[model samples]
Target: MRKNIMNRLPVILPVPAPPPPAHRAEPVLDLAVPVFNEEADLEPSVRRLHAHLRETFPYPFRITVADNASTDATPLIAARLAAELPEVEWIRLAEKGRGRALRAAWSASSAPVVGYLDVDLSTGLTALLPLVAPLLSGHSDLAIGTRLAPGARVVRGPKREAVSRCYNVLLRCTLSVGFSDAQCGFKAVRRDAAARLLPLVRDTGWFFDTELLVIAERAGLRIHEVPVDWVDDPDSRVDLLPTALADLRGIARVGLALARGALPSGRPSRSYAVPVTVMALAHLLLYAALRPAAAAQAVNALSLMACWVLAQPVLGRPPLPAPPALPALAARLAVTAGSLALLRHAAPGAGLRAELAVLAAAHLSLALPVAVARSARGGRRCRTGSAAS
Candidate 1:
């Protein structure tokens, strides 16, 4: 019996180990610099930034120079610096633009917080501490040095300053983005914030700066715009007129997006749903009552209902499959039934018309639901994201 039991020994089953618990490592702060043809500027800027980092930062830090397809010694200079400085990381992108290079570099960094400052360092290091402190303290997710921030000084030209003011005003009117200096090249982002932002951003040139800030603001990230001491670099690459024109066009794009109620990051806007629904119902009822057989009227009614169904799903409401037929017909029938019921109590055509008009107006009133939902969603989006827009 013992021999038989030994021979019948069963195979051992290996127990699967549970997954290691995810450790939330403290976020490391990283400094990113965008380089173009500034071989002359790179070394001096690196030295200055190194000095600033040594003097101020107590945490582990890394400096990344994103070489934007430079045709000069920028990459070589960066490599040399990286070799000498353990904290320095050199990133070379084949794309030949400051914005493109910066995006690539920022993406490559594993640090939880990252930011870009101009190679010229027009904004002072003193200002940078305040800008990044909020992020370090966990009070903000992003920081931007604002030249136009209240009480900030510009130790340079008044003409360019005037132009900046006018440009901001134009942006305010068009995009409704509320940044004091959206054009400021000095900006920082928390890793999660950057992850959400960089993908949605498409502009790879100078316009990238504005577009990024716009997207950040809309995403509801807490962006602290620190007032900074700014001095214009004598060798600035920006062409004011052309840059402004491009930014204006960007603002126009922003306006168009807003009109369609498209936000940069998050779930679709639910505010337009009820208004769209009301518009659809109104069109159908109006067509049936006035021009029932008109081709244009039928088309308009059908189009409105179709738009409503499409919008309803986006607005967090159930969608009707046959919107043009079922939803539209239902609205029309409701109006017709009401109008007929009222017609029996008064004048032939007058009472019916009045009843239809009142009903249409009541249907149009559903816009309030959309407005409230949009406002609440916008507020939530802001609290969770960045103070960018």
Candidate 2:
């Protein structure tokens, strides 16, 4: 019986001890300095960055020279630097956007913490460790060096200072973003957080930072801000006017998307039915009162503006972003104009009362959905704020 049992039993083979958790060494921090046509600045900036990290930073660090389609000797300098310094490496791209370069370098990094500052190193190197430490220690999902922070010391011309302040104010009014400085080039993020947020960030240009921060804030991520001593680089290559215009366009896109519930903040709870009805009635009454004294189009325009002004306070604490506002205004105007045209053609002898009634109905129809969507969004924000508190 024993012999038969042994013959039936299968031989137990030792499973080769699972390959000892492949001791893969990942850098603790990856600092990306993106450049475009910066042949003169590349070597000096990279070397200075390397020296600082080697002397002060107390972790495994790497300096990545992200060249954004520089049609100069920048690539050659970067290559030489990479070959010379074991801790430095170079990546070349066929595109020319700061955002594009950052996205590429950060996405490809195997490090736990990835960050970037402008090639000019406008932000002082002393702030580098603080910027990355929170992310590394898991205390925060992201960190930014803010020039506008209380303790920050900024040295720049009055024009640049004013522009920066105005831009931030615009962000607060338009997007309700809490971050003081959105355009600060010195910033860092954890790899895991970046993996989740990078895909949702659409702007591959100057507005990329603002879009990312706004989305992250809405998504309920903890952001750390470090007051940085930043000196404006006299040789800044940025074209302010073009960049500002692009940023405005970006704000519009992002704001509209947020208002329409296209992004991940979730649908708001409040209904706009009552508000819409009341506002529509008020708008119609206003149009009727003005019709006798003004042209149909002029009356419609005044009534529309009045409705917007009246609705603004009730909609929320701060006014809606320009993107959403512009569309709603456009829709109302289009409806009002179309209605006036059709009524004039169909009923050439239509009375003032009849015309006003028709125009009011048109305005109501267009404004109702917009009002409802915006009210609901406001409610969502309120709930979010309360919960956060």
lDDT tens digits by residue: candidate 2, 131-155: 9888988999999999998999999
Clashing pairs in 2: none
Give the per-residue lDDT digits (tens) of candidate 1, residues 1-70.
6345423333211111233236633338778888887889999998899888878977767788877766
Residue 36 error, candidate 2, Å: 0.2
lDDT at residue 101 of model 1 (Cα atoms): 76
What TM-score against the true fold does each predicted structure earn? 0.62, 0.67
Best by TM-score: 2
The worst-scoring run of ten residues by lDDT in candidate 2 lies at 9-18
Once model 1 is optimally superposed onto the true structure by TM-score, how far is the C-alpha of residue 190 displaced, in angstroms?
A: 0.6
In angstroms, the error of model 1 at 356 is 46
